[model samples]
Target: MPRFMGFVKMEEGIGAPPQALFDAMDKYIGEQSAQGHFLDGGGLFGTEDAVNFVVRKGETTRVDGPYAEAKEVVGGWALLQYDTLEEAIKGQEEFAELHATYWPECSMVATLRQVADEPPAPAEG
Candidate 1:
């Protein structure tokens, strides 16, 4: 089986999702979880209090957020597994449809990426 990570991105401070969307998601997630596909997932808070430890050259710099420049941010994520990429895509599309049907007023992007199973090769000198 292959694992995929889904990131839901949207504008910061968007209003809460409707109850209908929540209800639909709860039912959908329950079904997927029971089948052992929805491994883990959760929503995240706004970036106002987010912290960043950025490295440039040999120095590390700490940055805190309330990022004025960022128009969109990752709002939630899901860890899932499927037998094939096609199945994963289908599952993700269904999930995205829930939002489209229930929360049409809000714009969002749901990105699905396959998780890397093995570590990458070492960096060249």
Candidate 2:
């Protein structure tokens, strides 16, 4: 089965409702993992916890955060395995429903991306 990454992006300072959702989500993940629908997932601290880096033309330039765009930060991610993208998408909808039900006031976006089974092949020498 292929894997997909489902992520949650949110602005900081929303407060307790998201934390409550996370608590519930943790239990949900454990149950899903037992049922073989979830592989792994976790919550992340705010963007203030990040150290940003910019790589341009192969030169790496690192910067300290508090990132300027709080809205651009990703709060957490989950990895799920499924036979098809549709199954992965439908699996993540449960989390979306949790958000809508519990954290309606928080600015949040949930996204999904398919994970490649292997890294790209190197070019021939």
Candidate 3:
């Protein structure tokens, strides 16, 4: 089975979503969990309190967010596994549909990307 990393990208500072959407999402997540497609993941807080450690020029520097340039951020994520890409696409479609039906006012992107089986080489000092 191939693994996928699913992300929900939405504009920053939008405040909380509607209760109906949350209810629908709970149901959807429950179904996916029962079916074994939903792995480990959850929603995230806004970037106002986010932190980053950037590596540049052989040095790592810490940066805090509430970043001025950030337009969109990941609202939620999921680690999913499916037998094929078609199956994964179908799953993502159902998820997107739930959002479309329950949270029609929001603008967001639902991304499903295959995860690499192997990690990249370590960076040299």
Q: In terms of lDDT, which candidate is strongest?
A: 1
Model 2: colliding residue pairs:
none
* Candidate 3 ranges with C-alpha deviation above 4 Å: 120-125
lDDT of 2 at 59: 95
**In candidate 3, what are the lDDT values of residues 25-100, reduced to their tens digit?**
8988898889888887899998889999999999999999888897889989999988899999999999998888
**Which parts of model 1 have CA positions greater than 4 angstroms off?**
none
User: Model 3 compared with the native: what TM-score?
Assistant: 0.90
Candidate rank order under lDDT: 1, 3, 2
- Which is the better candidate, 1 or 3, if ranked by TM-score? 1
Cα lDDT of model 1 by residue, 1-125, tens digit:
99999999999997899999999999999999999999999999999999989999989999999899999999999999999999999999999999999999888999999999999999999
Q: What is residue 10's positional error in candidate 1, in angstroms?
A: 0.2
Winner on lDDT between 1 and 2 is 1
Candidate 2 C-alpha lDDT tens digits along 1-125: 88889998887756656577777777778888987878877778876767878999999999887877556678789888888888888888888888887677876788999998899999999
Residue 50 shift from truth in candidate 3, angstroms: 0.8
Clashes counted in candidate 3 amount to 0
lDDT for 73 (candidate 2)? 71
Ten contiguous residues with the weakest lDDT in model 3 = 12-21
Give the per-residue Cα lDDT of candidate 1 at 106: 83
